[model samples]
Target: MSIRPIEPDDHAALLALWRRTPGLRLRPEDEFVPFCAYLQRTPGLSLLCERQGRLLGCVLVGHDGRRGYLQHLVVDQPYRAQGVARALLRRALEQLAGLGVQKSHVFVLRDTPESLAFWSAQAAWEARGDIQVYSHSEESP
Candidate 1:
C-alpha cells in the first residue's frame, strides 16, 4: 500500500467511502467546494492510503497556526485492523510536527463504539476529561 497526500480529485471517492463506513458522519464542509477550499487552505496535510489504484482509507488534517485538528479518519471495512488508521495518523502527526504544530486533537463522537475503541487503544493519545467543548454556529439558534 502507498500513502499519499490527498488531492482535489479524491473528493467523490472519499465521500463514497465515508458514506459506506458505518460510524463516520458527513457534514456540509464535506461537500466539494468546501472540501477543495480546505485542501487549498491546509495544503498537503490531509492524506489517503491506496493500493493498486484503490483508496483504502483517508484522514483530513488541518491546523490553526498552533494546534492541529484531525477529521474523517476512516478505513474500508475490509481493511480494518490492519494498521491503515494508525499509519494515516502517524503520517498526519509527522506532517504537523514539520509545520511546528506540537499539539493535535480529534473529536470522536460518544455514540461511535468502534471509533471509541480504536482511539482508546492508541498508546500515544489521551482521552481528555478535563475540558468541555462548546460551539456556536450562526446557522443554529
Candidate 2:
C-alpha cells in the first residue's frame, strides 16, 4: 500500500471510511467544517493509506506546539495485521518529533478491543490507568 498526507479532497472518503469503521464516532451538525478547521490548525500530520487507488487506512495526528496527539487511527479490516497501521503511526511520530513534540498520546476507547490491542502492542504506547479523562460537548455550559 502507498501512504500520503490526507488532502482536503479526501474528506468525503475519509468520513465514509469512519462511518463504516467500528470504533469511530463522528460528530453531527456540520462536523466537516470543524474538521477542516482542525486541518488548518494542524496541517501535514494526518495521513491516508491506499492501494490500487482504494483507501485502506487513515491516521489523524497533530500537536499543540508541545504535546502530540493521535486523534484517530483506523485500518480497513482487510488491511489489518499487514503493517499498514504501523507504517502510518511511524510516519506521524516522525513528523511530530520534527515539530519538537516532546511526548505523544493517543486515546483508545474502552469498547474497542482491537484498538486497545493494537496500541498495547506498540512499545511506545503507555496506557494510563491512574488518570481520569473528562470531556464535554460544545453545547455544554
Candidate 3:
C-alpha cells in the first residue's frame, strides 16, 4: 500500500470507506465535506492509504500549534493487520514531529477493541493518572 496526502478528489472514497468499515460510526457524506474543506485551509493534514487503486485506510493529523491530535484513523477490514494503520500512524507522527509538536494524543472510544489494542500495543502510549472523559448530548444546552 502507498500512503499519500489527502486530496479533494479523495473525499468521496474516504467517506465511503468509513461507512463500510464495521467499527466506525458513519457520518453523512455532506458532513465530511466541510471538514475536508477545513483540512484544506488550515495547518491540519490528512493522509490516505491506497493499494491497487483502492483506498485502504486514512489518518488525519490536527494540531493547535501545540499538542498534536490524531483523528479518523480507519483501515478497511480487508486491509486490517497488514500494517496499513501502523504505516498511516507512523507517517502522521513523523509529520507532527516535523512541525515541532512536543506531544501527541488520540482519543479512542471506551469499547473499541481495535483502537484499544492498537494503542495498548504501542510502547510510547501512556495513560496518566485519573483521566476522565466528558461528553454532552446533542440536544443539551
Per-prediction TM-score, please? 0.96, 0.93, 0.85
* Model 3 lDDT tens row, 1-141: 798888777778987877776667654423667766657654446888998898889987778889888878999887899999889988898888888986988888777887888888988888655778776545526
The alpha-carbon deviation from the true structure for residue 60 of candidate 3, after best TM-score superposition, in angstroms, is 1.1
lDDT tens readout by residue for model 2, 1-141: 898988888889988888899977777622677777778878878899999999999988878899988876988888888999999999998999888896998978899989989988999788998999887777745
How do the residues 12-75 of candidate 1 rate in per-residue lDDT, one tens digit apiece? 9999999999878888889999999999999999999999999999999999999999999999
Badly placed stretches (over 4 Å) of model 1 are none
Instruction: Please identify model 3 stretches exceeding 4 Å from their true place.
Output: 27-30, 41-44, 135-141
Order the numbered candidates by TM-score, best leading. 1, 2, 3
lDDT per model, in order?
A: 0.95, 0.85, 0.79
lDDT for model 1, please.
0.95
Give the TM-score comparing model 2 with the true structure, all chains together: 0.93
Best by TM-score: 1
RMSD of each: 1.5, 1.9, 2.8
